[model samples]
Target: MQGPAVFIDLTLEDQAQELRKYFKSLGAEISQEKSTKGIEDDLHKIIGVCDVCFKDGDPNEIDAILNSIVSIMVSIPLDRGENIILAFCEKLTKAPDIPLARVCLQSLWRLFNNLEPSSPLRYHVYYHLVQVAKQSGQVGDVFYGVDQLKSQFAQCPPSSEQMQKLYRVLHDVLKDTNSELSSKVMIELLGTYTDANASVAREDAMKCIVTALADPNTFLLDPLLSLKPVRFLEGELIHDLLSVFVSEKLPAYMKFYKEHKEFVNSQIGLNHEQNMKKMRLLTFMQLAESNPEMTFEQLQAELQISENEVEPFIIEVLKTKLVRARLDQANRKVHISSTMHRTFGIPQWQQLRDLLGEWKTNLNTVQDGMVKVAQAQVELTRKQKAAY
Candidate 1:
């Protein structure tokens, strides 16, 4: 099983068939969500059949199976239905060594090419497939499909309203370095994720994609640089992308852990890690534009606002909708909205002192006027008496 060509030795085909049967039995137990545990050991039982299939043994059979899988993957989305794609994805984990499993993936590959705005199954398949792809590190498949969907034609073409779900799915998943496809293809596809005409949704999607593409960890840096998608948007969006990317410990921070673990720890060390928490609070205040439904601890983690500082800020922000707290829980914290503007008004004590100063100045002026009036009155009285 070298390249896309899957080869089996003469002795192994029978066991492969029986193993396929066994895998189908396990299909009921498969879950679509990502798991922390490795799928390798779990898949070992299934792949072991391929081992039995090889006249040469497990290593050769496994190579053949992986090759078959890789080959079928490229073309499956063009022809398969959503149900079948799912069935195949579940089957792959249980039956990776079998031809039937490869066939399921193959059908799935073909089906992707058939997706369009008019296709009844387009969105359903797109949504499910993107998530499956993400979990399995098959982003290249979805990326290629999306690339083909974005019509660059001048004439009216299929709309990407269907793509909304796909983008949403991607937004939830952390972009893994291992899953990168052609960066050029990814950028081209992402261009359609946000239709600038849709306003809020468009803005959000654009912002997400911009952040994703600008992310230093995303595998397609050269592709992003080559396409320059971020520049096409307004500077603010690009800045946001940069800011978020940097705030996530920067792409180079991994290297820093190796080279400067002490330094990184020292930075977080001050105030016994409270400094980072305060930074998060500031971010919540400044960067979060949507509903900031944050817990007190989350607020603490995000805003680094001290317990003392939080109460005052919470009291102040309560006037706005951004802050909320439970009366019984003193740990309650404010959820900052992204749109809130900072107003650094004069200090309350300073205002009080200025008011007192003005009052004293006015009192002195009134006193001087009263004394003058009194002196005039006395002179008039004295003159009248003399005339008499």
Candidate 2:
């Protein structure tokens, strides 16, 4: 009853002070073994107060109090610690703050390690630990995070929710571009991709890699290539990216595009020839942008293809709808109307620069012509005045 008034009538600072005093008194009673037995009867009341203070306390203050609580819980007998851990876990799940949740997970991890390996309550504790760890971005946090998840994954009857949770954790850990992904997690994902019994796990790992590559901000090679398993799949991975045209679109990926493209043609699948022609068509589209109207011979010369292949290839490119082009067989010329959105490279950048430069020069010329016309009219007016 008095708790509600203390929170409403007092400032946060005063409330903190009052709550600290109350917790100190409560904690002291826990250490007195004689009084501690009866303290169990008041555990609910003690937990309710701690929860409100934790929810309302300043971050630094909350951290300090949390440390104190963990220490106190550990110092108490195992039976008491179990109840305290359960209470804190319940409170945290209702409204989890990532940073505070991390502290709670650390405390929970300590308590969990003390329990028997076959304890039924361990699963409940492990589930919440994984949930908290999934939001962690650092490599160090991933060890416990992965451990808890892996244990749950190997349960007698595997759960789809656990599998989904595992994938979510992988995505978050790998996608944290700013943090260095721990080598353990990398190896785990690679092993899963190569040998998981369930196709979903393998597919999820592959999808995560594809996603990391698609992020323009992520430089995939430097960090990912460090792992030997991932290193061995370098060519395969690059080809996968190339198949999706990401290699051609992102300038960052272009550094390896040519080498990858050559490998695709020389050693990849039987559709190599068809794929090569499609790549040539993409290059031709870039060339056509700068020369909107070109004769079949000029197009052939620019593309390094014979004149006969030009019209047939142009027809193939038209079918893809990547470019809007018309073949004028009667006049031996091709006319391009527009191109679909394509990744810009150095060549495209140069083309845009040349176009802008020409426009600037044309604008200057128009300005000069206007100036001359203005001077001529002013001089004619002066001459008429002189004649008058």
Summarize candidate 1's per-residue lDDT along 1-388 as a digit string, tens digits.
0123333442233333344554444452333332243332223334333323333335445444544432333323434344433443443444333443343333344444433445545445445555555545555555454435454211333346555444545655433342233232335445553335433443443444544443423422322322234444435433343333334423233333456455334532223133233333335444443445556665554554566675565554444444343322554644443333222235535766897999999999999999999999999999999999
What residue runs in model 2 are displaced by over 4 Å at the alpha carbon?
1-49, 58-61, 76-87, 93-170, 173-176, 179-187, 190-196, 215-388
Please give me the total number of clashing residue pairs in predicted model 2.
Answer: 0
Report the lDDT of model 2 for residue 265: 40
Residue-level lDDT of model 2, residues 1-388, one tens digit each, is 0011111354333333444566666553222112323434334334445655445556566655554444444333445445656776676545346666665555556645544555545555555655556544333453444565566435342344544555455556555442233333443555543323434444444444544444433322333433334444445654355434433422323444555666444443223444445446655666666678889887676555787798887887788777898889999988989875345557768988998999999999999999999999999999999999
Deviation from native of the Cα of residue 296 in model 2, angstroms:
25
Candidate 1, position 325, lDDT: 36
Best by lDDT: 2
What are the lDDT scores of the predictions, listed in order? Answer: 0.43, 0.53
> Can you give the lDDT of residue 110 in candidate 2?
61
